[model samples]
Target: MFSKLVNPKSIAVIGASHNPAKIGYVVLKNLVSHNFKGDVYPVNPKGGEILGYRVYKNVEDLPEVDLAVITLPAELTLKVFEDTAKKAKFIIPIAGGFGETGKKGKEMEKYILEKAREHNARIVGPNTVGIYIPSTGVNTALVVPERSRFPGDGDIAFITQSGALGLLTMDSVSLYNVGFSAFINLGNRVDVNENELLEYFGKDEKSKVIIMYIESFKDGKEFMKIASQVTRKKPVVVLKAGRTSRGGKAASLHTGALGGNDAVADGAFKQVGVIRAYDEVELVDYARALAYGKPIMGDRIAVVTSAGGVGVVTTDYIESKEHGIGMKMASLDEKTKRKIKDEVVPFASVENPIDMTAQASDDDYDGVLEALQSDPNVDAILVYALFQTPLISEKLVDIITKWHRKGSKPLIVGSIGSNFTMKMAAKFEENKVPVYMSIERAVKAIKVLRIRGKYIERWENE
Candidate 1:
C-alpha cells in the first residue's frame, strides 16, 4: 500500500511549468533542487523547458514513473489521473475545491476513489500542499525553496492535517534544527488516511517517533486499533484539533473534520497510548524528547541546576496538581551526595535539585550525573545550566552528550539565558539532548518521557 507513494523510484509532474507563479514550477523545481535520486519528468501540454528538464506533452509521452503529482484544477486533476492511473502507481492532486467545499466537490472525490480502485493506484490528497521525505530527497511541498529552507533528516515523521501547522512548526524551530524523516500534509484525505500512514511509518526504520496534527479521523476506531500497535513499537504524538467550544465548526471548515466529542476522543487516545499535545509547543517538545531521550522507567527525577530558584520552580511544576504528571522530585542517595561533595564546590547542594551554583565546574555536573546513572531511585535527569556562570565551559557539552548516549534514562537540559546560552544549548541538541529555555518546558518534556514510561509499563503488565 505504501510502496510507490512514500518511496517512488520516479515521478512525473503532471502540470509542470516554467512559470515562477504556478504550483507546477515549484513542484518540479523542488524535486530537482532537492536532488531527488530518481527519474523526474515534467509533464505539460505546453511542451517547454523547466529547470533544464524537457516538459512532456502528456503521461503517454513520458516514461512510466512510480508517482505523478497533478497540480491542475480540481476537475482537470481527475482527467489527468484517469490517464495516469494506468501508468502511475501513486498520484497526488494538489488542488482544492474537493469534498471540503460542497456536493460537487464530494462527487469529484468519489470519482478519484473509483479511479484509484479501478487502476489499483492510490491518491495522497485532493487538497494538500504535499509531503517531504528528506532522506529520499522527496520534497513535494508547494513552498518555493528561496522562501523556505527545510529541516535536515531525523527520526520524527511528522504529518499535519493543516499544511500551515507543519510549515509553522518547521519555521519556528529552524534555529533548533529539528530534523524529520518525513513531513506530510493530508488535506481533505481522499484516500490515504492516518490508518494507512501509521502502518507504513510504524515499521519504518528511519522513524523512531511519529507526530501529527489531526483535526479528526476518518475512521476513529480503525485509527485506535492501528495506533495501539504502532505505539507499542515507537511513540505516537497527536495534536487533535477542534476539541474546544467552537472546535467542531472550526474543524469542519478547516479540514472538514467532524470534531467528535472531546471526552470520548481523549479517553480513546489515552486507552490506545497516544500522547495528546494541547498546543503547538508541546507538539514539537514531546516529539523532540521522545525522539532524543529514552523512556523514563519511573517518575523519580533528578533536577541538576546552576540556579536554585529555577530548580525549585521545575520541581514544583512536576509535583503540582494542575500539571497532573505523576512525578516525584528525587532524593539523592548517599553515594551520589558523596561524589558531588567531593567534585563540586563546598557551598553547592548535593540533594534532589543538585544546585552546583555559580562557581561549580563542568566536572561537578558530570560527577553527579555519573553518580545518578547508577542510582536505583532515579529514572530521569533535568539539567539547567545558566551559561553566564564564569566556570561553565564548553566541556559540559561532552558530559551531557556522553550521558545521553548511555540511554539508561531520559536526560533534558533546561536553561534560561540570552543568545550565547542558545548557542551553547545547540551543542547539547546536536549531540541528541533536547534543550528548553523555560523550566516549564523542560519539565513538560520530562513529563512526556514519564507518560511514555507509564504506558510502556502498562503494556508490560498486560
Candidate 2:
C-alpha cells in the first residue's frame, strides 16, 4: 500500500514556485538538491522553470505521477488533489487549514478523504511537512537544506505526528552522526495513521528500529494489535504525549482528537512489548541503542571505567530499581578478574565496576573488555571512557568499537566532560557503538536492551 509513497518512480510538485519564501520552492529545491533518482515534475499555472526542472502548466498535463505534493491553500489544494487523483497514486497536501482549524475545515478534510477513496488513492496529509528518504534522496519536507540538516542513510525509521518536531529531531540527531532509513511526518493523519505505518516499517528490511512521537491514536486497539506483531520482529519505541488532563486538552487543540487514557495506554504498550519513552531524548536514545546494540539477555553488567567517580555513580544507577531500571553488576569471573588486574595497576579496583584509575591506558581497556566478553556472568558491558585521562587516548574509540562488533555481549559507553569527551563519544556513536553523556542515560539504554531481550524470550517461549 505504501510502495508508491515510499519509493515513487515519478513525483509532481503541484504548486511549484520561483519565490524562495514559499514552501513550494523549498519542497522542489529539496528534491532537486538531493538529486532524487526519479523523474521530478513541477506544476504551476504561472510556471516557466524552477531550479532547472521544467514546470508543467497544470496537473492535468502531467503523466501518471506516483506521488503528487500539493503545496497550495486548503481550497486550491482540494482542487489540485482532484486533478492529481486522476493520475497520481499518492498525494501529500502540505497545508494546515484542515480539521485542526474548526467546523468548515473538518468538512473540507472529509471531502478530500471521500474523493481520495473514490480515486483509490492515499493521502499523507492535508496538513503536513511530508516525508524524507535519505537513500533515494527524496525529501518532501518543507525545510531549508542549508539550515535544517538531514541524517545520512541508516537503520532507524522515524515517524512523527508533529512536522516541526520531526524535522527538529532529524536535524538534532544528525549532529551525533545518527542516521535514518526514512522519516515520515503524519500531519493531521487524514488517511494514513501510525498503526499502518508501524506495520509497514515492521516489514521494511531497511528499518531495524521504528520510533514514533504521537499525541493521539486513530484507533487505540488497532495500534496495540499492530504493535504486538511488529515488536516480535523489530523493536518499536514510542514517545506518547498528553499523559495529563491539561496535556490532553492541548493535544486535542493541536491534532483535532482527544488523547487516549495514559494509564490504559501504558498497560497496553507494556503488554504488547512496545517500549515507551517519556521524552524526546529517551526516544532517540532508546531507538539508537536498540538499532546498534545487541539485546541484553541477562541483567548482569560489567562496567569498565577510567574514572572512579563515574564507575561509582554507574553502579548506583544499575543497582537501584527505583525507576524500574534495576540491573545487576556482573560478578567478575576469577580469570576475568585476574586478567583485569594484570592489565591495570595493582591499585586499580578489580570489582564489577572495574575502576582502572586515571592512569589506565587504551591497551588496558582492550584487554579488560576482551576478558569481560568471555565471562559467562557478564551479559553486557558499560565502559566509562573518560577521554581526559592522560593514558587513555583516542585509540580507545576503536578498541570499544572492535569489541562491540564482536557481538558476544551488548556494549554501552558513558562519558561526561567538555568538548574532548563529546568528540570521543560522537566517534563511538558514529561507529554504531551506543554512547551516552550520563551514567543514568547509559543505564537507561541498557534497560531498553533488557526490555527487548525479555520480549524476545517471551515470544520464543510462546
Q: Candidate 1 clash total?
A: 0
Instruction: Flag clash pairs in model 2.
Output: none
Best TM-score among the predictions, by candidate number = 2
| lDDT at 281, model 2 | 87
Clashing residue pairs in candidate 1 are none
Displacement of the residue 58 alpha carbon in candidate 2, Å? 0.7
Candidate 1 lands at a TM-score of 0.93
lDDT of 1 by residue, 111-137 (tens): 988998899888888798888888888
lDDT string, candidate 2, 364-414, tens digits = 888888888789999999988788878889999999899999859899888
Q: Which regions in candidate 1 have their CA more than 4 angstroms from the true location?
A: 244-260, 323-326
What is the lDDT, from 0 to 100, of the residue 226 in candidate 2? 93
Query: Which whole-number lDDT from 0 to 100 does residue 101 have in model 1?
Result: 95
Off by over 4 Å in 2: 244-261, 343-345
